[model samples]
Target: MNAPAIPMIFSAHRRTLRLTRARHRSAGSDAARFIAEDMIEDTLERLAFLRHEPARALVLGDSTGTLVASLREQGAAVEEPAALDLEAPHPSGGYELIVVFGLLDAVNDLPGALIHLRNALAPGGLVMTHFVGGQSLPALRAAMFAAEPDRPAARIHPLVDPRAAPGLLQRAGWKDPVVDTHTLTVRYASLDRLVADLRDQGLGNALAKPAAPLGKTALARARAAFAARADADGKTAETFEIITLTGRRSLAGT
Candidate 1:
């Protein structure tokens, strides 16, 4: 008998992980490594404060292996899965904790992803997810939108509203879901620099239907509008609203 084929719908999503690694390698800076380090430290601190003992953890979208490395250091058996969509069926065994950082925005099946995440957790297992949401980079979004007003296809990816994320967790059968938001302010010297950052972060707009490119006149106008909003210090302020959602598998069902 032939072995069953793995799902094909998730293949494209998995390629995103490879793309993320390429960006990090091409950057050749400590930036990616540093971001991973900071993420792990913050997560560990949060877990400690909650008096949680992590025995087995799964780090979703562990592109660069930073979080997985840290969890392994803490003596927790860690599984770093590269699949991005999370549409596949959950594994039979349960994980004590699941950490998903910076992946949901790119996943096509957000609701299905959450369901799979919940199903993978053991009774009372906690799931922590962090993603960009709610008016993040509005200035940039506005500029891009204005650049090619005729083409709505050029609009960036739709972000989840922070206010609605907690409810999504609950609807997915998680218990005690909580959602919180924070803004990351990054100052750039110019619009070009900001665009560069976005590219390096693998955040370039991937709209299925992209708007037409802005003509020279429109591009100039958009640039002027962005710089006009720059701070007195001559730095453009880019805001990324990060939504952190946490929930636990219902103990009553398991």
Candidate 2:
């Protein structure tokens, strides 16, 4: 029997456009890079703790460029491709280390992507990927709901739940897979700032069929709803849960 068809919920073209726009924004101005920085830091720490040194590494979705520099400083030959389609098979393989920053969350066939990552690695190679998890953006979600309480649309892209990651890794044939999650909290004075930050960090919606833009009245309602949840300091707290998945290819190349 043929495998079940993967749902086409996300558009690869839109995802590329979002990333391109984010790169342009970052180049023209000092856009917020806290998300990428955090992922790089966490990845470096994990590499250090495990004492796993790689002679060759492939880094993906590293908008900040710091991850590549750091890896180079460690004497590793790193490849930072200008563009790569996560849903398709990688052009090159035999990487000893593969680190992905943010693209996994937007891929339509996540399990297939994971399998591709595993296939790209050499025997005993390590793969680490970090992306926003399902529990993130409660404040933004609430505000979107308030924008169209009666006829809400699908504005936010669905995220991966940490609970389902292990099964995905197993299906991908990863050896010694590990799934971990942590939350980052940020305080925003307004919903606009929050949305801007998300766009700056390349976390914009990449759904195949995005909802129509909010009108003036709906936007006002969203702003008001967000402001209503502000704390005494006149800022609303927003949480982002980052999920990290790490695993190694079997020595037998399975």
- Clashes in model 1: which pairs? 153-210, 153-211, 154-211
Residue ranges of candidate 2 with Cα displaced over 4 Å: none
Question: What TM-score would each prediction reach against the true structure?
Answer: 0.82, 0.97
What is residue 44's positional error in candidate 1, in angstroms?
2.1
- The local lDDT score (0 to 100) that residue 139 gets in candidate 2 is 91
Estimate every model's Cα lDDT from 0 to 1.
0.70, 0.93
Scored by TM-score, the top model is: 2
Q: Highest lDDT among the candidates is held by which one?
A: 2
Model 1 lDDT tens row, 74-126: 88998875553466567654888999866676665667789898888988898
Clashes of each: 3, 0
Reference-based lDDT, residue 101, model 2: 85
lDDT of 2 by residue, 178-237 (tens): 999999999999999999999988899999999999999999999999999999999999
The C-alpha stretches of model 1 lying farther than 4 A from their native spots are: 1-23, 30-41, 210-218
